[model samples]
Target: MPVTTRTVEYPADGLTMVGHLALPAGADRRPAVLIGPEGPGLNDFQRRRADALAELGYVALAFDINGGRWFSDPEEMLAYVMPLLADPDRMREIGHAALDVLRAEPRTDQDRIAAIGYGTGGAIALELGRDGVDLRAIGTINAVTTGRPGEAAHIRCPVWAAVGSEDPIMPPAQREAFTAEMQEAGVDWRLVVYGGAQHAFHHPTVDHTVLPGVAYHARHAERAWHDVVGLLDECLPVVSPA
Candidate 1:
């Protein structure tokens, strides 16, 4: 389907976050998705993801984290994102703000919305679910951060998380802890660890190196995207009118 793209700006975390909105070609309301950017903030990579979702007949919003800025230096990105990760409130705030933008669109069917994020953005999506948002599904890539004590219980939708086996940032212990929390909370969740892949494996090649143990795996990236689409197909499928 032909898709329309636009720039959206919203306020969150005391900064004006600029996001990219993609609308599928249709007159009827459609299921919407919230796309959170990686720790480096929103960039062309995320914008293209939104466009892909739009082409798939869904409204997608690629939200920003650093007030319309993109960070190339790993240290600089970590300097800004580390503190945000520690503060769940701030993460939820950013997620909710983006959700609001998605919901406000006339093309969006508010009842059928999903949140998917990459890296830091994935953590934000999980935070939204932990905060009890009414998302149909939550998907994360390379982010398996455990939520607050007993907070996973608030997630009312299916959770899907994917990480690379060699991702040092989300090692086996961390993945175990995250799954344990979900199991204890009784939330329906699944975790996929791609063998031989690294952190940010889903991301395409960039001009500069992001971080050690962080590289794109083309095969695993396709597989992970298939898994995410399956999750959405099951949890938030868009029905065509007869």
Candidate 2:
């Protein structure tokens, strides 16, 4: 079946967010996924991932983070995204806005929604889990961060996270802390550290020259995608429409 794509513009907080939605050609309801891009915001990379998920018979929504704008420079992207990460409430609001958009689609099986995010977008997906939104699976790449320890208890789904072993953005110490938090919260969680891969290893289009701490590894990217899709298949299985 051919996958269809469209732009979905909606209001998030005070910003007018522009998200990309992809739906598989089918009449049956299917599990939905929300894709969140890194601090630079939504781009071709995330949009393509959404389309891929849709081709697998899922409704995928790649939502905006920075008001439909993406920054090329690292300093500029950090300057804009750092503040948003500091405030959990704001993250929750953004996630809620995107979640509502995913749920509103007629083909979405609301009961089996999942969220996968990269960098800051991963953090937003975690916020939705912490807010007790009842997601089936939560997947993050190079974006796992420990929230308030108590908040993890509200996450009612299995989580799959991956990061490059040499990723400066999320080092061993950070991963350890996040692991401790997840263990304490008793959430079903899995973590993978790809050897020698750098931050944003899953993003093939990301330019490491412009972004100092990030680099792309095609092999690891493929492995990470397989892991995430496996998580979704385990948590939110969809029967093909004959």
Query: Would you estimate the TM-scores of all the predictions?
Result: 0.98, 0.97
Top candidate by lDDT: 1
The residue ranges of model 2 lying beyond 4 angstroms of the native Cα positions read 207-209
Residue 109 lDDT, candidate 2, scale 0-100:
92
Q: After superposition, how far is residue 209 of candidate 2 from its true place, in Å?
A: 4.9
The digit string of per-residue lDDT tens for model 2 on 132-185 reads 999999999988788975999999999999999999989999999999889999
Off by over 4 Å in 1: none
Q: Per-residue lDDT tens digits of candidate 1, residues 1-242?
A: 47999999999999999999999887899999999989999999889989988888889999999999989899999999999999999999999999999999999998999999999999999999999999999999999999889999999999999999999999999999999999999999999999999999998988986788999999999999999889989998888656
Lowest lDDT 10-residue stretch of candidate 1 = 233-242
Clashing pairs for model 1 are none
